[model samples]
Target: MTNEEFLSKMQDVLQTEEELKLDTVLDDLAEWDSLSVMATMAFLDKDFGVKTTMKDYKNVKTIGDIAQKAGL
Candidate 1:
């Protein structure tokens, strides 16, 4: 998937159109709590077929990390 596609998917998962800049910190998002993490994990698995755990998320500090994982 492309970075744009990844961002779109993230927006959908996060349920916001609040333009996610690539450098935006995940923690900066109000919706980015544990539930959001689980949602993201599910999104990755369902959409990209990439299984991930909280441990995997520990290394992901930015939206770019998600894009990279999605092979953008």
Candidate 2:
């Protein structure tokens, strides 16, 4: 998928109205909570066929990181 599509999906995953950029810090997002993590895990698996654990997020600091993981 393209980067724009990935970010659009992330907006849904995050349930946020704010626009997301590649460099947007995960920590800076109000929706960056446990629920969002779980949603993201499911999103990645369902959409990209990628599996991720909580440990994987330790190294993911931005929305771009998740896109990269999704192979975007």
Candidate 3:
């Protein structure tokens, strides 16, 4: 999927109204909690066939990081 689509869909995964950008830091979002992380894990697996553990999130700092995981 395109980067734009992925970013837009991430709002759903995050359940937030905030506009996300490639450089937007996940930690800066109030919605970027444990649930969001878990949802993101599911989203990646369901949509991109990518697998990620909680441990993987230590390296994920921004929206772009998740996009990379999705191969966007």
lDDT for model 2, please.
0.92
Sort all candidates by TM-score, best to worst.
3, 2, 1
Clashing pairs in 3: none
The TM-score of candidate 2 is 0.95
Tens-place lDDT per residue, model 2, 1-72, is 788888888999999898999899999999898999999999999998999999999889999999889988
Estimated TM-score for each candidate: 0.85, 0.95, 0.97
lDDT of 3 by residue, 1-72 (tens): 888899999999999999999999999999999999999999999999999999999889999999998888
| The candidate that achieves the highest lDDT relative to the unseen native structure | 3
After superposition, candidate 1 runs with Cα above 4 Å error: none
For model 1, residues 1-72, the per-residue Cα lDDT tens digits are: 667777888988887657886788887887777887888899988988989999898888888888778666
Error of 1 at 50 (Å): 0.7
Collision count of model 2: 0
Q: Model 2: clashing residue pairs? A: none
